[model samples]
Target: MAEGTRRELFTILETSSADADTVPDGGETPVNLSMDVRWFEIPFREPEEDEEQDEEDGERENGCRSAGGAEDTAGGRCDIILVTGNGIKHEEEHPEEERYYSVSYNCSDDSDIDFSDMEEEEHASCFGLDGDSEEEEDCASPHFWGEPDQVISIEPFSVLSGPQHSLGSDADTRDYFRLLFPDSLFEHMVEQTNSYALYRQRRSGKSDPHWHPTDLREMKAYMGLNILMGVNQLPDVDMYWASDIFIGNAGFKKTMTARRFEKLTQNLHLCDRESEPVRGERGYDGLYKIRALLDVTENTMWDSYTPKRCLTIGQGAVAAKGRFCPTQYMPSKPLKKGLRVWMLCDSRSGYCHRARIYVGRASEDATVTALAYRVVTSLVRGLEGKHHHLFMDSFFTSVPLMQRLLRDGLYACGPTEPGRRGYPEVLRPCNVGKLSPGEFYQCQRGNLVATVTRDSKVVSCLSSNSAPGLVGIGPDQEQQGEGDDNWTDTPEEGGVSFGVPRPLPLLLYQENMRGVDLCDQLRDCYPVGRPCKKWWRYFLWFYVNICIVNAYVILRESRGSVPPGGCNGKHFTQRHFRVRLAQQLIGDYQGARGMERAARKRHADSPIEYGHRLERMSERSRRCRNCTNKGLRHESVFGCKICNVHLCRGGCFSEFHK
Candidate 1:
């Protein structure tokens, strides 16, 4: 053969190398595996071609070796070289044929391969699924998580549809909602109102009340249920008229002067009435009557009762509670509307922007008086005998107003600054001297009842029979029989009085006790007035305001539509879920309706097509399983009768139809 340049031959292997510890090395010979590799051209020599040997023997066997031949071969006469000229030793003893085991492994290079760990020019937007590796080329393509935001698209479905067995999906709220909503609760409201009435009757000893001022003043001469409550109940609030204890205000911008209010009629619209400077008395009766009308819508039914045929209404309101300036009122004679209509307006303000439309027996005009009557509609119909306290401030604490309150079967009391003067003499000095200096307007004076010195006014009063008493419950009156016997009976009490008055009644009667916290007292209220909004923030402010004003304002923004039980945080999640479910239902309806337009829409968005696809998919899924089941084994007539889907006994044979 002609001589040619030599080329090198080497073997490259891909193997699962055994860890260093897996290999046995008793002597600890140095083994290096990660050495750098370099490529080079080297001279190689071809071995002489060995001819195939023809077997003269009958069987294939090992080389014939005589005793003499072994010695001859050991002398290095054989030329199958085991040592290289590079001084590297080669294995002289090769693997025995019997020890050899062949293992065949087949795997695709790309299968289960994690490209995330590979070294490559990563194009995040590119799917890398196709042969094309350019991201710019696929810029027009829609991909999940590629846009600014992404939302999972689910086809519309109804909770009520399908099987009733799957109600657990939204069971946390739906069941309770159905029970606690309009249906059951409507009737329940009437029941609760009646119960409240019964409670009020037992608490107030006067089963029947006289609206006459003369009767009220005469009653005050003697101890009323309020004076008795404090001595009856221990550690109870000294409550009298609910209004006296409750903080209340009316946020009204005097739009129409008092004269305009006196002559108010259906002909005068709230908007048509000028924004009369409310700086002077705008006739309090008209405005007040209007307020009352608005409040009574839910509670009263004025069809039957009539002691006072002519009741004056009051009015005036600001849009928001940001700016407040207290204004006085004058009752212009007696203007009556058994269920009269007067235009009461809430002026342009922030609160009005948020104010919702509240209707009560819609009359020609909606006013405060209308609201008041509406508030009592259900109460009057359900529980006519309930007594309510109509507390007021020095502003409305005139003896005459108290008489008016008595006419309505409501106990009236407030800080009698200058107006009220026909109450019985009280024990304690006026605590809030800042309100009215030295003179008291409604303190009890002997049995005849005198609106005496403010300094001598009772600090607090209660109404419940269970409330504590004044004289019977001193710190020394412990339960021991000795403490009980030591107590002296008063001749006024006939000396045969039950030495221990009922605590609840006594609590309501303790006019001698410390005055209540103005803020805390208004915890229960239908707010009437409020300070401006610029002055407050957060729920604390709202709560504080609610506590301060007996104005009867509904907390609308802070807590939207208080649940049946009010703003209870415990039901927060449930309420939220209810809202979500409602939103879902609405959205589904809209989508379904839009599709109708989509069918007609020539240039509808992709979402429309997606909706159609979803509808088709839903239709397919709802097909029968037993009769003509698409993905089912052959069956006779056991298919889903309603949906016409093929189903089997083994797979949900008892599914809901429709």
Candidate 2:
């Protein structure tokens, strides 16, 4: 080999000693290993001389040459040694190049390898691996291929055990029905509905006859009717009671007067409670009872309608004005006031999987770690053993949470704090400006992986399931730097521009994080909630609307009907669905209230009438069907020539005609 090209020789020691595995006692001398080896040589070259070397010289010098001259003093190989104690000896092989030698001890040798060794720089040298070959090998190893470093330098997260089973198949037609209507959910609802049974047991014979006690069946129906009416948004009780309006046909017994309706609403209760009549208290000391009812109903909805695939956590703001309103912060009014709620919703259907009201930091000891763990775990509690992916904002994502979730068989991806402890410093935002738009840095420690990409803005994310892969870029219209004026000149190609490339993590984040916002948008349209003095009443209305929205989503999917103009369906909008639900609930109670009366009455069409035929008819005073049914009286003025029925002239002349 060329003198300058061959630098350092690496020795491979093969041993036949049985005591090679044992370590010596601490107060000791370095152990000597006697080993036999077949010497191997790898080609190497100095950086400056590499360009000038001939290719023909490299091909002929492929194998080790026998030791010769002062340069090859050890037969082109050195004796292998094992060292112990603090000041172990190492040979100075080259005076020009700095070297650090790592010893691999597989055997104890009797031949001592001297550390007080030196070789002149001009002497013939041994060859080892070249830089290009070493780098290519390292890049191909999957263990630490794209990572900045091989070790997790920060404090490690507390990881849990893996789940015993896997998530269900990825097919859309998989058995998701059981999740939507579990038997446990039904059992809980039944228990809640029958809670009023305790009140009946306490009744005494001395109670007033006028004290209309609540029945479980009747209470449920009354609650259903109230939800229905709320959706319809009647101006007042009088409008619902109007005989001419369609709402008047909402079912009850014929004896159900306006007074009875008012009484039913005022006395409604889900369960009996201990009487503590304090003045000015909301619900007259029944607030606790109502709150309990809300809690049970909301939980039942969650259990009964579990979301299938991707879950997202987002915040919602409900406007309120009262001393009772909880102190909370929203992006719109951070210093001002509103009620805040954290919602976990399904990305596809926009159905809320779970929700929790956010009180101030005092109530929950609100650190980011504790809050994130609670919110994510509670929302995905029923999803154990199912490897669902969770998406969230920066407020609730951390390395520790990602590790915990992955161990519990759930995967999560979201923007998180790059500077937080345990996060890889290489993925920090401060290092992002050095990267171009399509470039990113990735690092992995165990199952947790962190990625930072430079898009229009720097995005840092931690994911357990996804890798830092690139899918493609978004359309040019969405690019931040472009303008409409730039695209207008391109007449033949239409006003379009190519988009910037996007990484997979940023794309997934954008797609999955809008679930809660979708829910907010749906509820905002045709809102059923009205202004109320009591705070809990707003929650009552809000939940009722959410249930309806969930039901509508299910119905749309099951019915398989396409709506025009981007409405829900051809025949049914959300309002129409609400009206139909109200009608069904009330109708099931007693057929629509005035339906039977209206059906039995004789009538004539305005544009088309029955043929006229003159026949002798009775002149006696008989009741007019329309007036008699509505509790009005009129004598017969003339007989209909067609059907021989009597009718009054002034109002009933055209009412029953020819």
**Candidate 1 structure quality by residue, lDDT tens digits, 71-153:** 23222211111112222111111122111000011111211111011122322221223324332233222221111011111
Which digits, one per residue and each the tens of the lDDT, describe model 2 over residues 17-72? 34443423111111111212111111111223343244425432321121012123
Q: What is the lDDT of residue 222 in candidate 1?
A: 18
| Candidate 2: regions farther than 4 A off | 1-265, 275-299, 302-306, 318-321, 325-327, 332-338, 359-366, 430-439, 454-456, 469-471, 477-492, 562-573, 588-658
Candidate 1 Cα deviation (angstroms), residue 637:
52
Question: Where is model 1 more than 4 Å wrong at Cα?
Answer: 1-385, 393-397, 407-409, 416-442, 445-592, 595-658
Pairs in clash, predicted candidate 2: 32-109, 33-108, 33-109, 34-109
| RMSD (Cα, Å) of model 2 | 20.0
**Cα deviation of 578, candidate 1, in Å:** 6.0
On a 0 to 1 TM-score scale, where does candidate 2 land against the true structure?
0.52
Q: Which candidate is the best by TM-score?
A: 2
Which lDDT value does model 2 have at 477? 55
